[model samples]
Target: MKKTAFTFLSVIVVMTMFLAACGNSTKPSNEGKQGSTGNVNQEAPKETEQPKQEEVKLRVFSTFGGTDAAREAFAGALDAFQKANPHIKIENDVMSANDDGFRTKVNTDMTSGNEPDLLFYFIGADANEMINAGKVVALDELLDADQEWKNGFAPAALNFARHTDGKIYSIPMTGFYEGLFVNKALFEQHGVELPTDWEKLKTAVKTFSEKGIIPLSGPFDQSHYLIEHFVLAAAGAEGQNKGLVDGIEPNWEKGLAAMKELYELGAFPQDAATIDLSMAGNYYSEGLAAMILEGSWAIGGWKDETKANTTVLPFPAIPGGAGTGKDVVGGFGTGFYMSTATYENAQKKDATVLLLKHLTSQDTIKAIATANGGTPAAQGVEPDGLPQAALDGFKMVGEAVSISMPIDSKVTPETFNTIRANIQPILTGEKTPAEGLGAAREIELANKK
Candidate 1:
């Protein structure tokens, strides 16, 4: 669910108090959208020691195309950070999200002993590997020293940061919550009273389909997305499904109920089975889809395309429990991680610390937050109010269930393949919901063996 700056460098280089660092100047690479530098502070922390007057460089591993407006804004923030520190130089290296480029690059670097000081990575097995190997530094001491940074975040907001040792390896980029992104005008035009819960959502899908509108701009290609939706729906049925406040795999029944409902609703496209994450935004934009269970990241897409008015809201509250519309399904955005190895030199380490501190400043976060159409992570730093729809979209991310990110890479490749290929059948009605769900789960279980 996240990317930005982090490293996969060969485990941590045990450093003494020496003032010099290890020599890899090149940046580590990423496998998703690359994003680079910026500085912001909700509460100012002491500027760490500076590197010597000699030229110093900090590498950036990001997902941004690096030439886009958003990237430009981030770059400007880094420029400002350098100005404040007067010693840090930044080398921004961009990478592709295609296939396993990011992951491959990270694995190769870590095993090769040449990992970049900072690279973008997701939290799960990928991070666990580095953390387990004792390559990454835990942020506990830093958080303790800077109470402000800890205060800036919501409790449990950075849970993914925990290493096997119960330590924090990385700082969370930003918090994101997931929900049903519905096309308001489309639903109204089709006389589908927005769904309030399981029954209502199903009925709404049926209503939308009857009017020739596909009810879902599905992410069946991201098979876990389907599982997430069904699970959420079943949780709603429980009146207060605790598992849903954060995405969870409770009894498979919850997910089963949700999928069965969607299947019967006939809400997805003819090729729902084939749709991937990329299509979710586009489908909604083109008016080919009525709803999508996506994260706030799609807000930009809806704003950028589509003529119909779009508004995202939480999935209908489950009947009777504490859940219904009370929480979300995702978590925050991206952030950067510094390499203790690269900062080995006293001077380099000082500069790196200053740059890292600057990157999280309020001014920088505000700019990046705005350009990407994101929410500011800095405490009390509010963004300029945009259209009502946009504001509501931001609110949706925090109001829904907490994020429970799936371990996409932990399962067997074959199981992952089946999920990517087979889940679509039920989504498109090519197979029964039970058959589709069973097949996918069966594969996952098989992989565990």
Candidate 2:
């Protein structure tokens, strides 16, 4: 009986030990399955993950919109840049070059700390305020750092764009020439001679007015071209360059007087006092007017027929003035300016600079010059498909006795604004020639003080 009981106990102990070992082996197998599944889950996301690119945005301000000749070309260039860099975005802010309000807007934005990343503006006095306030950065070092970009520009163009302090703050895209753009068809139809001199101009104006055709299409309110040409014609390059800084030049007064003489002969549009430059351009473009005192940039915006029939000439010297009748208002006057804010922004600096370089590249300059008829600032780049009028303008510039920057460049913006404001009053006999010029001189003096 005792042996049988002991045998039963041994059998129970062996069964219990076998069951415990089986349980331990099963637990390890289940844990191994879980560990392998966890490893697979961890490796799956790593295999499919991609790095995300952060997008950048930039704003560029310029006079490349609102019927400007190079509007489409400018848009196309921006499109190309955007395509090349999908990670970057651009906001093209534009205003008409003819709009006086644009100047005010730019000045206000720059001074009020709302400046754009890129600014297309005049290089001389027009930029002085921003430059003096340190709103823009000098690009001399940047240009020097990029050999290809620096070498692409015409040396003369770069030199011409230098500020008074001998540093380049702007990168020139194209140079411009302001002249008398004439529709030869109109002159020929009326049996009037081309306005090669003051007397011929008077004759053409008298004839066109009598025949019910607008003689010279220009706005008294926005009389920029008229003022520029008349002042250049009367004052000549040297006197015009003297500005109102040393008081008003007698020749400047004579220039205003010449404008009055033309006004008396109905040389301007009937609605000249109320019209803006764009309206005045429309008159000439639609063939309602015979001539327009405008810049090379105006050529491409004219009607096809008018453009084909057009020719450019220097404004003739006013009688008894200092002008040689060959002096011209032209040169690399305007360019792209980089704001100090943009240059200092670590996030935007590189991309903004890249955009600037692309815009001012040789190919881009050629494209813009082709559209606007402005002289290309890129070295060895001649624009294709130039109109005869543009070719004539180039020839005229080549033959000019002296090519001077516009009068506004030689004076302060406030002084030029004063001059522009007085154009209508001066034309209507409300202000004498001396009075108009004297007012501008006062503003200039106050600004200088």
Candidate 3:
């Protein structure tokens, strides 16, 4: 997990991004119903009153569970919905957003005809598979029926989730921004300047290592994302997207070399290959590491102590690269999807739509954004009450020349897997950057059809 926004010819560019690739790897719960509804009391139906309509169970499957920043916001919204519409019982099936298996589990459920009445999932090309499989319901009618609600979202945000059919299938919750989370105290303590270019980054690595601190903490074993970010910085948005559908571009090899160069300088954690992403974040939060490459959504995870000294900055620029340190790897990836089963049923449809409305309304979206340090997908979102670091991240996103899509979103699942598996060897010095990326490119080109 992330899609494209810059259109070239007939292509409808859309951008998408994913949470970190580490979490509890448990399979989606197959226990059927998510949770029981609270009891509702009813006075004996008076002869004058028709029997109360039977309770409608609205099943919702979400990948926003666990300790995700948006989890509390999501839960709060659901609680508010349940209180408002007691007749519609909400059964929530929550999966870890960081779990790579979540998407597969959802696809399996869809194929097995166990689709939830509502799905909280990715938009863009990732959602296209379900749309083509006829498992997704177009939301044009829903939007038309509630134009007032539709007007609340940014038109660009809506376009990010719209499929090739020119109809929206998902309601994007919040947009995201990716960059370096710098520990200001660490840099100050080590007497090293913050990195704004590759040379400064190297100087930091040398200085931090002498003090037994990890210069940068990241999951190098699952670092296709890091490579994506680097390549975007090296090539800019247009250059990175140019060779995606064809073959690997020169900038990709150059970008891989750049990362390998850093690894050779011991820039990353010693256990970068083995550490889980959450553990890496912990290292940074606890002051054991100087910096981490992370997205805006991860801002809330840092402890208040760390947040007090934290500041966000665009990724350091590469020498002779096209990037101005303004392009970012981010956009809308996770969002809400309503199933055809829910849309077609007259009984459940109304309540289900209402629930969706509540979950994605401006208030709810703002809550999620503020909690996660993310940009609200809906327009006119004021940055009131957000952490100063988050506000800084937002400013970078606003000034970005072009927002890049995550590599996983741009390639086939198989190709993405190939990249993830092969890139680690380069970091470990077992494979040359050229060799590692070459193998990945072959897989991408072979399976591109």
Task: Point out where model 1 deviates above 4 Å.
Answer: 1-52, 65-72, 82-87, 95-101, 124-126, 145-160, 235-250, 253-257, 260-265, 271-275, 304-308, 317-327, 345-347, 373-375, 393-422, 425-449
lDDT of 3 by residue, 1-449 (tens): 12233421101111211111224232222121223343336554467455566799988999778668778888888888888667789888898766677879888988888889999987755676788888879888888876767876766677667676788888987877788889998898778999877788889988887788898888876675587777887877776766455666777777777887887777888888787667888898888899988888777888888888888877866777776777777767678898887788999887887788888776777788878877666555543467778867766665666676676766666666776776678777788766876777787677655
| Model 1 agreement with the true structure over 1-449: per-residue lDDT tens digits | 22211210100010010012325232211111112223444434458433346777777676544222256766786777667545567877666342336666776776677666765566544565666565556667767876655665433435445654677666654444456777777777766787656677878888878878888777556655555545554444232222221323444444554565676667677766555556655777787888877655456545444523767676664443334454445434355665657656665665665555556655555566565555455444444534455556655543333334442434444544564565656545576545654565676565445
Question: How would the candidate models be sorted by lDDT, starting from the highest?
Answer: 2, 3, 1
Better of 1 and 3 by TM-score: 3
TM of each candidate vs. truth? 0.70, 0.88, 0.87
Worst 10 residues of 3 by lDDT: 8-17
Task: Write down the lDDT of every candidate, Cα atoms only.
Answer: 0.54, 0.84, 0.73
Q: Report the number of backbone clashes for model 2.
A: 0
Candidate 2: misplaced stretches above 4 Å?
A: 1-52
Please report, as a residue range, the 10-residue window in candidate 1 with the lowest summed lDDT.
8-17
- Sort by TM-score, best first: 2, 3, 1
- Report residue 166 deviation for candidate 3 (angstroms): 2.8
Give candidate 1's whole-model lDDT: 0.54
Which candidate, 1 or 2, would have the higher TM-score against the true structure? 2
- The model with the greater lDDT, 1 or 3, is 3
Two-way TM-score contest, 2 vs 3, winner: 2
